[model samples]
Target: MHRVIISGIGAEIPEPVITNEELVASFNSWVDTENARRADTGEPLLQKSDSDFIVHASGVKSRHVIEREGILDPTRMSPRIPARPDDALSLEAEFGIASARKALAHAGVDGSDIDLVICSASHHQRPYPAIAIEMQEALGTKGAGFDMGLGCSSAAAALHVAVNLVRAGAHKRVLVSTPEIITGHLNFRDRQTHFIFGDASVAMVVEGLAQGEKRPGRFEVLDTRTWTQMSNNIRTNLGYYTRTAQEDPYMINLEGNLIKQVGNKVFKEVTVAGQKFIVEFLAEHGLTPGGIRRFWLHQANARMNAMILKLSFGHDVDHDRAPMVLE
Candidate 1:
């Protein structure tokens, strides 16, 4: 089996940063007005949120959103990205192509060298045309392309698959791009998770290293493990066929289509599950937690990562040990 190495990496972040202060102010203003309206109708008032509370809860001080003006608007707290023509590249594909181009350049390889293109992300722009295929066409690559979704772990899962394909000699080079347009699915009116997600695309070039290849500076994929369990703690209730009888069958609304998460349940369950997986994964490979130099964990929450590391390592790890990028 050939060894797989990560030759290069690149990222594409949308412009216009939305600070937590700005979001909280707009959200609270909307909440106050909504509450006043509800009071007139004898309905329960909506709760107000604070910036400090948001930061402490999720450790997200700000985020990069695709539509800055519309999301921050008190009236319409949603992204207003216009739809593109069928022939034009979708927004997700545009970002994916930008990141993939940078990754290919960094790898010192052209698009022709990529044997496969994998578009793994939290969500896709459309259902008919696979984004991976569109990316392949845009890059002028002559290989197969596909899409995969694993929620928040989509990129890691895709990396695992790319590594295996390269090791098995199925492909000499693979381009994995994760373009997360998460804000499009978020209900900004909902205070629980409005401040969680951001917009960005990350790309990586994975290539097979033949015997005696002297790539001294490249990083090798030693091992990877993934596990899945049935749970509804985090989910979105939306699909092409799902619809209310009273509403149009094809019309998608934000009511049930947006992301819904049980914060407490997810925090507890994922902390335990993540720690167990890391411990077992390292142990299986004859490695220890302390021996690992750096831990680039998922950019979720600061407190959650801290707790998971503490439980797994039997000690408290500092920021240097586990760096966070959610902010």
Candidate 2:
């Protein structure tokens, strides 16, 4: 078996940005319109969203999105990404490739050096013709490519697989590409989830290391493990069947199918489970939370991460100890 190291990392954040004020204005406009329409129906008026509430709730001041015009348009609450021709490079593959190229450049290798490519993301534009395979061809990479998703853990899961493959001497180098255009699946009309997600793509190069060989500025893979338990607190029912379920197959339903979540449950459950997992994992390596130099926890929620770190370390952690990329 060989040792594996993360030789390089790269990311592509979209150009367009949406601040909480802009998001709230759009949401509240929709709420007002809906409330006006339901005035005589005896239905309760929809509550207006506030930028301050968004910040206090999720700690997100702003977010980068792949598109701006559509989402900001008070009439429409979704991003307007034009569908590309099948023959042309797809958006997901394009975004993944852009990040992958930077990762390859950082690793001092070409796309051809990557024997395997795994495109893992929270959302995939299509089910077939795997985005990874499309990226492989576009990058002129050899060997095999595929796509996989495990919700928010997709990128980490792909990295775990790449590390194991390199450790087993199956491949010299593997690329894990995550192009999450999650804003597309976001329900901008929903006050609870409107300001939560942003679009970004990231890539990492996992390579094998030989004995007596060393690479500076690279992280050595110590150990990798995953724990999973079924929960529906966070979910999205938008899928192929969504179109089929509609009375008109051509008509799309944007109400309940998009992303929705029980934020309180997720925050509580993840914090408890995440802290226990971190403590146990560190203990297995004869280490403690305080012994670690840095912690790169998920960027889902700032408060949840703080609570998890606090629970694991038995005290509140500093911002420098666990930097956040959510905003």
Candidate 3:
């Protein structure tokens, strides 16, 4: 098997920060001024100690990109002042670029070197060209590319796809990206699924660059396994646009509590499978969990991260580095 190593990385997020105050003001004006005031009824999470164990999480704080302000429904309502040009790419595309640039920068490689570009995202509706083409044009790449879907696992699976392409000789360099802008399709009235997602994207690069390169990096492609159970009939899925919210087309929906109950249960029940995934991932190089240096899991909240870490390594390991408490 050909060896595929991570060589260079880059990322780009939207120019919009949509700070809490701005969001509160914007969201308030959209709804009845009375109901808009409710958006902040729940105390803003930003005020709480960053170290406090998270509870009653809501999706509207921290960081996220907005297409524009003052023009709530740009597609329909033409606000006097328009949105910024960078917002033209839409939130998903914006987030995709965010991590793409970071990953490229990390690998010390420019976009020109990527031979294959893979976008693991779910919020694109343009039909003239695949988002990858626009991404390539954005990065100025002349590479073969495509897009894939796998919900929250899209990021991890994109890595697998990059390694496979390198090992199969289809390409020598690959850049994979995963981004979500679910808030674009959110229905504020649908409290069942609202208030759980933040917009973001990340990019990673794996290449067949010569092994003797200057800086050190990571390698090894184990295996990827997917499982579907009763929850598939109920919980577990992606966040994108909703026809129901067509008037508010850009909003995204995330079934927070539903995901929590189902995900926590899966975290508990999937221990054997999770361990097996670990075992198989290591068997490729005669290694195991102890041999690995990091575990980057995307937990929705601190509570979820704490529970999953306990499952993966008990409650003893340092989790400061884990990607937890997003949203």
Candidate 4:
């Protein structure tokens, strides 16, 4: 098997930041003040203390969109959301392709040399050809293009697939882009998770273990693993969409307890998870995190991240300004 290393990483974040105030206003106008207020109010299931709330729980404070130049009415999004899912795919495609092209340039790889294309994200749904097909056309990838969906774990999972493809003699060079446009799907009316996310596309270039294909200075993947159990089975709660699957708004839902309620139990599994998998994967490959310059725990937002960081690194490591949000 060829050892793979991340050759380059690039991301595109749209310039838009729709705040909570704007969303509440739109909801008020659409559903009347008295009715909307009654609907949103209840026992605050989140944040026992302000400290418990994730900095960006909603997965949005602001996000990028073509016509989102100023304050926006949630109900009256411009260009009019198409009735079909495919149209939204293309809309997302525009953002994905632009970000991918930028990623190729950033990685210093000519599009023609890309042996495989992997496009992944947690938001958006399409009815026809695969989303990756659209991305392939955009990036001019003549090798292969496929869409891989794995929830928020999509990016890391893409890396695993890309590496395997190279090892299997499928593709030597791989380009993977994770463009998450959660705004269309997110439910900002729920204040808890509304603060958690930002829509952005992060891309990466990886190469097969070849003597000649080496970036001058690159951080190689020392080890990796997945706590498969962490993948939620049935998404009963959501911040990605609001209202029922029937409600017209069709926004995302953020169930804060998805992490909060299960926080303690999961931490027990995670405590030795890194050390366990790291030891095994490294022992098998002859490597270790200690040998690497840094380690990242694919975490997003603030609160749960704070808790996880505290459990994993303790007071010794200060994740106060880590690039975790970009993960």
Best by TM-score: 2
- lDDT (0 to 1) per candidate: 0.89, 0.91, 0.56, 0.59
Backbone clashes, each candidate: 0, 0, 30, 29
Candidate 2: Cα lDDT at 149: 93
Candidate 4 lDDT at 203 equals: 85
Report the Cα lDDT for residue 156, model 2. 92
Q: Alpha-carbon error at 37 in model 3, in Å?
A: 17
Q: In model 2, what are the clashing residue pairs, if there are any?
A: none
Name the best candidate (by lDDT): 2
TM-score per candidate: 0.97, 0.98, 0.65, 0.70
lDDT of 2 at 2: 93
Error of 2 at 64 (Å): 0.5
Ranking by TM-score: 2, 1, 4, 3
The lowest-lDDT stretch of 10 consecutive residues in candidate 1 is 245-254
- lDDT per residue for candidate 4 within 189-267, as digits (tens), equals 4433333445678888887657567566776664455556553422325434435553565543343423222333444
lDDT of 4: 0.59
Candidate 2 achieves a global lDDT of 0.91
Evaluate model 1: give its lDDT.
0.89
RMSD of each: 1.2, 1.0, 7.3, 6.1
Clashes of 2: 0
Q: Candidate 3, after superposition: displacement of residue 204 in Å?
A: 1.7
Q: After superposition, how far is residue 104 of candidate 3 from its true place, in Å?
A: 3.4
